[model samples]
Target: MLHGIDLRLPRGRWTAVVGPNGAGKTTLLKALAHLLPHEGSVRLLGREAAAWRPRERARALAWLGQAEAGAEDLLARDVVMLGRLPHQDWLGVPSPADHAAVDAAMSETQCQAWRDRALGQLSGGERQRVLLARALAVGAPLLLMDEPLAHLDPPHQADWIALVRRHVARGGTAVSVLHEISLALQADDVLVLQAGRLLHHGPSRDPATHRALEAVFDHRIAVHAVGSQFVALPQLQLGSDSNSLATSPSED
Candidate 1:
């Protein structure tokens, strides 16, 4: 149901897609990853993504979906090592390079201590990090993450942002669908969606981007400049009832 939803994510940068629920944010990511059927063309690294083999596409761009699950009995590090499968032949054992990549991914994600833990036993946040580590282990130049920060604490969320920055610094590209406008502001670019349409797509610094975001949500949300940071906050939309303050507890 997306319309005119073209996006260009520059290499060595992070782009955050933000929007209300059911705005086709996840659908857009799926389409770009060739996980879902869509009408328009989707290109990765200057070639049509659909033309690539499954293993080739998986190698070129690793996607960390919002609700990902792996074998419950598998160890965390083993799961991360699974990312290297595309580079190996069927029934191939883990090579030294695979081990090195898995170790690096675990260290980067601070999951080294849980390397031997079963995936099913980890907490939600821990599992989320483990999945991200798996994605990182693939060593793909392009990464797509949907709601990657969900269930993460503030510190881990910050760490994830720093990790993304490091990845981009190494000539990688990342596209993430995020709900937190404040955290998303840290990305180099932003794509705002509304009603399955591309409301705006450009640098995060653009005032028009903020305006489109505010307008798309019908001003029920307000975008304000707090120092150098742009924050989107829920604003009360008052009804005609004089006895009620329009704001709900959640809005406040």
Candidate 2:
């Protein structure tokens, strides 16, 4: 449902795609990953996305999807191993490098404690950490994630931010479709979308970026400086008799 969209994401930088419900943020992400049929051109690492072989493209780009299915029966560690399939040969056994990468990823995500457990046996947050570890184990130069913080608590959410920061600092690129506007503001840049169109794309700290963010949500939210960092907070306040403000449910 996207229209007239053309953008060259910044190399080696983090950009968070954000918008209200049905703004096409997830659709745009899937299109960039070449996971959806689209009419526009998408370039990856100076080459057309369609030009690369499937395995080669998988090696270059890692994707973590929202509400992805059918991993419940796999053990936690085995689920992470799926990321190494692109680098492994057909019917090949896990190599030492693969083992090391998996270990490191698990350690980074703090999910090594339950490596033996099935995905369905873990809590939502634990499963998310394992999935994130799987994505990281791919060792790809570009990472795309959708709603990565869905089940994470605040502390782990901070950890995820630091993890992405480390990834970008190591010369990799990151793109995430984030629902948490405050968390999205932490990215280096922000791409604001509304009604399947681009409203603005710029540095997260830019005044114009803040304005576009506010506008997309109908000014129900406001960007404010809180202790030297930009944060998006709710502008709508409930009356003294009201329990809380009502909000419409969000969707892709």
Candidate 3:
């Protein structure tokens, strides 16, 4: 349902896609990953995403969706090994490089401890970490993630941010759909969508970006700087007279 949405995500940067529910944030990510058909063009690595060969696209970009369903019987390590499919030969044997990539990805995601465990046996958060590891194992220059923070606790969320930061530092690109405003603000740039259209796209620190965010949410949320970081808090609309304000309405 996206219309006239034209934007370029720079390389070596982390861009977060954010908006209210049903704003087409997930749709935008899917479009970028070529999972959905659209009228306009989506270029990745100097070529149209739709024009790339399937195996070539897989090697150039990795996708992690919100709910990734797979065989429950597979071990965590084996699941991660799937990311290396594009690089493997017809025999599909795991090369030393593939093993190293999987090990590094699992270690970075803090899921190495559960490498031998079955996916069905892992907790939701643990499964999320393993999926993240699988995405990382792809070793793609561009990573597109939708709601990657789902089922993650605070510490693990921070770890995810760190991982993305490191990836960008190494000249990789990351585009993610995140509901957590504070976490989204940590990214280098922000793309705000509203009702399947582009509302704003700019650096996270720009005042205009914050204003657009507030406007889209009906000003019920306020972005504030907590020390060096910006945090989004619910705006309290209460009467001036304390006694008159018996109840306060909160917006999400």
Candidate 4:
């Protein structure tokens, strides 16, 4: 059970959810998107999130899950086109509008060149871009992604970051659950979680935010400003001679 997760994501900005494993970061995103049931108020676009219709909610909020699972045998473009399912008729034929949206999504994610390739044949990074294209096809105002950078190369990961920036630049809102602290620092806002509770939620530049982030991951990690970016490094632990000798085997 997550307790005290009262976070407010600002409009037209990117917010990164950071925490150690089992910190409820994924759960928090799911709950905010109404993909998971939870207690407390969750307002999306000034409406109580729970009150929105399933179809309406889907078109208003897009979700890219950790695995992006489904019909792996499908072609990359077909998988991307699946994002249009929310807007299709009972027959689900792609309308001209649908095609335009799909084209735009593919172009934005840079997957247009690989549109005809089978999803299974794509590299891990390629598949992630395709999945992002699928999410963008929804054309939602709010996008929630869980580990969207999984299996991506540095260049593609940077591409994903740029895509997110473009989306938010165009009046979209995004919340992502990410483990990469360095990339997370690029977001406009940060939400730190620890043991199913909110550790801090505010602008990423706040000193308190950095301190709380450092504390939650333990003092072992330090957050420092490098140029205009904040990066985290793992601190080394020193062992005392007494403790080391105590574990030595007894002499025969």
Candidate 5:
């Protein structure tokens, strides 16, 4: 349902997409990846999206969806290896490079410990890490992840952030849909969407981006600087007056 949208993602950087529920964040990601049908043309790597062959597109763009269903029967390692499909010959066995990629991804996500287990047997957080590893195994320059932090503990979520930072530093581009405003603000840039429209796209530190974020959420949250980071705090409306209930000590 997005309208009149035109975006140019910066190369070799991370962009976080944020908005309230049903704001077309997920739909935007899907359209960018060409996973769903859309009216306007989507160009990837400066080429028309539809013109790229399926395998070529798959190798260029890796996807991790929100709570994807029905891979429970597969072993964790096997699931991650699926990301190597684009590089392997049809019906061929996994190559050394493929195995290496899978191993490295699992290790990066700290899921190698349970690589032998089936997806159905793991905890929510564990499965999330495995799926994250799967996405990483793709080794695509552009990654599109929807709600990648789901079910991760605080430590793992921090680890995810660090991983993304490293990916960008190493010259990869990534776009993610995130509900965690603090983490979203950590991204190099933030793209704000609302009611099927693009509200803002700019550096996360930009005051204008902060304003758009606050406005889109109906000012229920306040954005403030905490140390070197910008955080969104809830505003408790008390009659005619409003006060932030979650402001950090430093920002207070």
Candidate 6:
């Protein structure tokens, strides 16, 4: 349902999609991926996204969606091997290149240690990392993820950021829908949506971007600077009386 939206995401960078619930963030990604029908045009790498053949598109973009489901009996390595399907023939034979890519991706995501573990036996965070490895194994120029931090703890979330940074640094592009405002702020650019409309799109540090983000949230949240990074905090509402127990100075 998004409208009046026009964005040209840069290559070799990260663009984070942020918005309140029902803001159509996921819809936007689906549209860009050609998974949904939309009126407007979506161009990837200078060509219409829909113009590419399905297998060609699959080779060009890697996707990691929220709540990825897989067979519980499958081992982690087998799941990761699925990312190489685009390069495989109809029989899905793994080539030497595919094996190397999977190996590297597993090592990068730190999933190699559990490569033989059944996906059902892994913890949520562990499973998340394995899924991320699968996405990375695709070796596509662009990667799209929805709520990729779903089951990751704080440290692993940070690790995810670092992994994406490394990817972009190596000339890869990443677009992700992130609920964590602080993590979103780490992206090179931010696309803020509100109720199916494009509210703002700009560098994350731009003052205008911060203002639009605050306004979209109805001023209930405030963006602050902690050292070099930005943090979003809940705006505390104080009583007009100015002497409420919550606000009153406490005696030792």
Name every residue pair that clashes in candidate 1.
none
Q: Name the weakest run of 10 consecutive residues (lDDT summed) in model 3.
A: 243-252
Best by TM-score: 2
lDDT of each: 0.88, 0.92, 0.91, 0.86, 0.91, 0.89
lDDT winner between 5 and 6, please give it.
5
Error of 3 at 52 (Å): 0.9
> How do the residues 1-252 of candidate 6 rate in per-residue lDDT, one tens digit apiece?
888888899999999999888899999998888888999799988899989999899999999988989999899999999999988999968999999999999998888999999999999999999999999999999999999998899988988999999999999999999988878999999899998999999999998888987887777678899999998776766777676523212100
Kindly give the number of clashing pairs for every candidate.
0, 0, 0, 0, 0, 0
Off by over 4 Å in 4: 239-252
Error of 3 at 112 (Å): 0.8
Candidate 3 per-residue lDDT, tens place, 104-132, comes to: 99999999999999999999999999999
Residue 130 Cα positional deviation in candidate 4, in Å, after optimal superposition: 0.6
| Residue lDDT tens for model 5, 1-252 | 898888999889899999988899999999999999999889998899999999999999999998887478899999999999999999999999999999999999999999999999999999999999999999999999999999999999999999998898899999999988988999999999998899999999999999998898888788999998999987765554355334322110
User: What TM-score does structure 5 among the candidates reach?
Assistant: 0.94
Q: On a 0 to 100 scale, what is the lDDT of residue 189 in model 3?
A: 98
In model 5, which runs have C-alpha deviations exceeding 4 angstroms?
Answer: 239-252
Candidate 1's residue-wise lDDT over 30-51, tens digit each?
A: 9989999889799898899889
Candidate 2 colliding pairs: none
lDDT of 1: 0.88
Clashing pairs in 6: none
Model 2, range 126-168, lDDT digits (tens) per residue? 9999999999999999999999998999999999999999999
Return the top candidate by lDDT.
2
lDDT, model 4, position 203: 84
Candidate 3 deviant stretches above 4 angstroms: 238-252
When summed lDDT is taken over every stretch of 10 residues in candidate 1, the lowest stretch is 243-252
What is the lDDT for 107 in model 2?
A: 95
